[model samples]
Target: MRARIAGVAAYLPEHTLTSAGVEARVRAAGGGYRPHPTIVERMTGIASRHVMRDDQQASDLAAEAARRVLAERGTGPERLDLLIFGSASQDMVEPATAHIVAAKLGATCPVFDVKNACNSFLNGLQMADALIRTGQHERVLVCTGEAPSRAIRWKVRDRAQFVDAFAGYTLSDGGAAMLVEAAPDGGIFYRDFAAVSAAWQVGTLPGGGSMHPRDPEFTYFSGDGRRLKDAFVDNGPEIFCTALEKTGLTWDDFAIIGVHQVTMPYLEVLRSILDIPAERLVVTLPEHGNVASASLPLQLDTAIRSGRCGPGDRVALIGLAGGVSLGVIFAEL
Candidate 1:
């Protein structure tokens, strides 16, 4: 038995932030700020990014993507057995984001949010698969919405960290939804997934959660990237390798690799560490930056639609996020 995707959809922000635009804002703000797209361009490999307006929320963007997924699959919310939302950005602290997305979609299904930082979606996928495999549910809708642009702290003290955090430039406002069903036949399939967490040292916002005690200014739930490279280096390869092993496969066995890419170095490093082909890696960070959890799904949808991926294409979604959480997932596209 295999848990496979029935449909895939994405929602990208209407706003575009270019190199010139970012420079202009930094220069005008002038709190010892200057325009620098060098790392952003090199790391994310994206030339531009989509940003959500202050008025927009993660649920709004997620609903848009969910609509696309449902339409593409010819599915209605009424038929959905379970809806899982993977989000770090939520409108309220008490209500789960999944319920909000369901409400917006006119869905009356059992819904909840899965949050493991940027790893939320992959975790959600795993849980949905477990539920389906155990005959607990069918037609599980998996959603990932990230509006990290809202929480960006442009003023950082660390220069090297900021360069990689240049992911901020590539990080955009968007969401992705995919319909996962029990498939014993041909369909996009999930092979395996694994997660690990270190000390939660690298990525985090100062305020918002109970640990920091929320403040008005910290409402965005931002993050710090001072040691992003360290976070990736610490556990990315290990978790990714474990997933591949669980599936009885190797990095070289897959046709395409899609790591949770926020930077170009992430790909290069993972490729080198795992001894996978550079060409085997499918990257969208250069064009879209990091769409948070949506990054992989959005890029995967585009790659499939654009003929870059084909029937029987095996792709890997691997990366690390805040809380020092790291993981990898194997998908058969």
Candidate 2:
């Protein structure tokens, strides 16, 4: 048996924060350095991003998307043989967020969390596929609730701080769920992943860990965006290119290719590198911002709803995370 993605769902909060609004907030915070108007949009190509309500937790967003997936499949959470909560953000640090999500959805299945920066969902899918192929489980729910906005640094102290926290400005709070089940026919066909562990310092959320357990200063996200980009570029696209070579498939073979998007320039760079057709790509960063682990699923759901891709169609999920990891998962929907 193979693991197939049976259902995909996404949820974005109603509230939006425009790039200009981000600058306004920074200025309002009485930071010493004042940013020029439209700088955020100009640099990142992100017009706006979703913001979760103050009362909403990461589990709440994940549960919302999971509910939609369960409803669409005409099943209940209890039927899920496994649930994986995959995200960069969590409601807390003690209990795995998966447990919290399971409680909210009334699911008693075995659960755990997968954290690998933005590639969390892709890793979760990879694990689910392996487990199903090994006959350990029949159905798995892979979900993510990313509230990166909660850690965004609005109080910019200077140009250095702003540049370090630039990546946070592109983040948007959202949730996504993908139901993977056993299918004797079409399912995940190929997957590849690579990472440069030495590049881990390129980006980070330093709070809640042993290094900075009580340091309020480490609560916000900090990173060198240029370094992170350089790390990926240096790591190269062998994972994706090798997949195509080994599978005898070209970019055109996939009906839809959902690449984890951060900025328009970077997306174009990757597309050019891989030679993916324009029509096959989904551009969500402009309006949705970078939804972290939710980005790929959001693109898949959009493509399915927009009639861009459907059942029996070939799809590719390409992931890039801050840890400078790369991944590719090709499947037949």
Candidate 3:
């Protein structure tokens, strides 16, 4: 059985944060010499990023996206059989984000959350695939939202803090929704997916967890959790290579590669290391930055709506995130 996207929609907060604007704010706040925001953004080809209002969290952005997607698909919230929230910045820890989305969208169906750092959405896709395969649910609504920039520690604490702030500048808040149905439809169809984790490698949100032993007053966090970039880079080659091997195809089979984009540096590294062509990969992080789990879907929506998709077009969705996990999956558009 093929799990396909029935409809898709996205929501970017009203605010667009430009690199120049951020640089100005940092300079006015008495920060030392920092590279021009354009200089940094140029590296990723990103022009601007969106930040949600203080009152908004992942739930709000996700619900809005879900509503739009269902409406555009000519479906109602009541028809949704399954709802999944993929996120790292959920509104609460006790109750899953999917519940909140269901409440907001008036969905009384089975709702849950998928958490796996940046790979949450891919994980959700994998789960939805299973439900479709087993006939447990005919249709599932997958949603993702994140605001890594908002949680970034902007204050200069030490050398480690600099990397955290550096990473933060590349993060933006956004939401994406895709209504997936168990049908061999005209839309993109899910193929295969896999995930692996190495938790000791990289992490954020060390405050509340028992492993960190946090003391907000006495304890401090630098956010540059030790070679986080290296951890991701190290896993890049084997991940994509494995995906290709499983599909019994070569780089030539694909038209575009949509990887979990965090920076231009990472994209270049992946391209060179994975043997994927420069033109085959799509880069949106510079303008959208790292919109968390919504990264790939938002790009997919843009490509499809812009008339960039075609039959027999093979595409890869690669994801990397919090658990120090990496995922690469094949899909037909």
Best by lDDT: 2
Q: Estimated TM-score per prediction? A: 0.88, 0.99, 0.87
Off by over 4 Å in 3: 28-39, 42-45, 158-160, 184-201, 211-226, 310-312
Model 1: CA > 4 A from native: 35-39, 42-44, 155-167, 185-196, 217-226
Q: After superposition, how far is residue 63 of candidate 2 from its true place, in Å?
A: 0.5
lDDT of 1 by residue, 182-211 (tens): 877554344444444455654555565686
Report the C-alpha lDDT of model 2 over 178-261, residue by residue, as the tens digit. Answer: 999999989999999999988989899999899999999999989988888888777758788899999999988999999998
Q: Clash pairs of candidate 2? A: 312-333
- Number of clashing pairs, model 2? 1
> Which scores higher on lDDT, 2 or 3?
2
User: Pick by TM-score: which candidate is best?
Assistant: 2
How much lDDT does each candidate structure score? Answer: 0.72, 0.93, 0.74
- 1 or 2, greater by lDDT: 2
Q: What overall lDDT, based on C-alpha atoms, would model 3 receive against the true structure?
A: 0.74
TM-score for candidate 1, residues paired by index: 0.88
